[model samples]
Target: MRRPTHLRLLAACAAVAFACSAFAQQPPIERQMSPEQFKAAGLDKLTPGELVQLNAWLNRTVEEETAKAASEAKRKVVNENRGFITFGSNEPIVGRIAGEFRGFGKGRSYTLENGQVWEQVDEARLAGVRKSNPAVRITPSVMGNVWYLAVEGSNTHAKVRRTK
Candidate 1:
């Protein structure tokens, strides 16, 4: 009985080995050539029109990739530097504000002037004003111990108080 069992196990092992060998004898699935290989294989011998189309396609692909990378980098920068506002007493307010504001009031809190702190506002509400009134200027003014902001325009002269 022990011999018969051993022979059965040996036969099974031999069958498995034969099956594996038979499978290995077949050819593997062919892989597509890389872009370099394709070029080397005379793909570069395309017509002028085809070359133009290829160049345009390549340029568009590069542009899309570049734009995606730039967008991701900008997102990372914004995430790293969030909830903070940079203001200049003499600079234009419109330019001081970022193109698209995100991550505001998400990390830390801080104040701007004497008691004026940063607040989160919807982009849509601010977008129209920022676009239509692009020349608005914000400046810090001190009255005794109180601090105030002033808005100026192109046609308007300086020293005109717009805010208290």
Candidate 2:
């Protein structure tokens, strides 16, 4: 029932995003003209009111572009060479644990083979769990500095915090 509305909202946002990127703006006339050409065209002799309007438009353009750039940069994935994991990013980490996978329990920290450390923060205990070097994945939650760890075969999971 709610899926349709959610999909519609997603489609609308995607359309808006596509339109914004598709409409590449041409350089304003103020920037395209050389100083000599601008002076020759008498644009340099504008009234005070007209000059103010031109400056205002240019300033607004710059501010809007800067804000858009910052917003787009937030969605970028961090490079693997930097730290292999990005804080506050929704990217998932998948690998085997350093030791045997005895399943999730409260107040436990599991070190993955990739040299990342995640400490269980919630009381989710798995029954009948025993494996060696089982694959695991830690996914970031919507909130900052929060994550959930899930083993490869079990539906059980636990809230975890990355210590390293």
Candidate 3:
């Protein structure tokens, strides 16, 4: 005799429950962020008084986002410079360095700490160290006819010609 459809459904649910329980015994993933970091990450763009409000909003957003059953909780921020851009994954203000050029040239590469490498072209070499042993932070600046790229985490800087 064939079993009832409801009984089959009940067995399937039990099997799923058992598998989930078994997986739950593993260690939880660890991730944490500090408030000082949040503030240092361009959060100062907003007024000091507005920080609390912003923090609350971020917290609620994170909570609501994390509770979604079918969502991937990954966040990234990207900033563009004259001919360069940097990317940060879940890290405030600290981003990965990247660049492209119209006339810099070929066969030029910048090497960072741990042997991470990037390429420079044309007049980019005049800007001093293209890449350093340690990855550098970059901020935007202008000086007369030259455009400056200031490294935040270090004292290194690069100057490139302004096409526009």
| TM-score (C-alpha) between model 1 and the true structure | 0.29
Q: Report the lDDT tens digits of candidate 1 across residue range 1-164.
A: 33453455456556555654554443311124576876777756877787667656765665566556555654543332222222223332222222323222222222333322333221212122222322233343433212222223333212321121
TM-score of each: 0.29, 0.47, 0.24
For model 3, residues 34-134, the per-residue Cα lDDT tens digits are: 65665567664767567667666656655554444212211111121222222222222233444432222334453323223434323433333344333
In model 2, what are the clashing residue pairs, if there are any? none
Q: Specify the highest-lDDT model's number.
A: 2
Which sequence of candidate numbers ranks them by TM-score, best first? 2, 1, 3
Deviation (Å) of 19 in candidate 3: 21
Candidate-wise lDDT, in order: 0.37, 0.69, 0.38
Error of 1 at 163 (Å): 30
lDDT of 2 by residue, 48-147 (tens): 7896788678767865885576455433323221122334556677889998878778888898897777788899998678888999877776755567
Itemize residue pairs with steric clashes in candidate 3. Answer: 104-121, 104-122, 105-122, 110-118, 113-133, 137-152
Off-target runs (Cα >4 Å) in candidate 1 are: 1-41, 85-164
Residue 49's C-alpha lDDT in candidate 1? Answer: 81
**C-alpha lDDT of residue 160 in model 2:** 81
Name the top TM-score candidate: 2
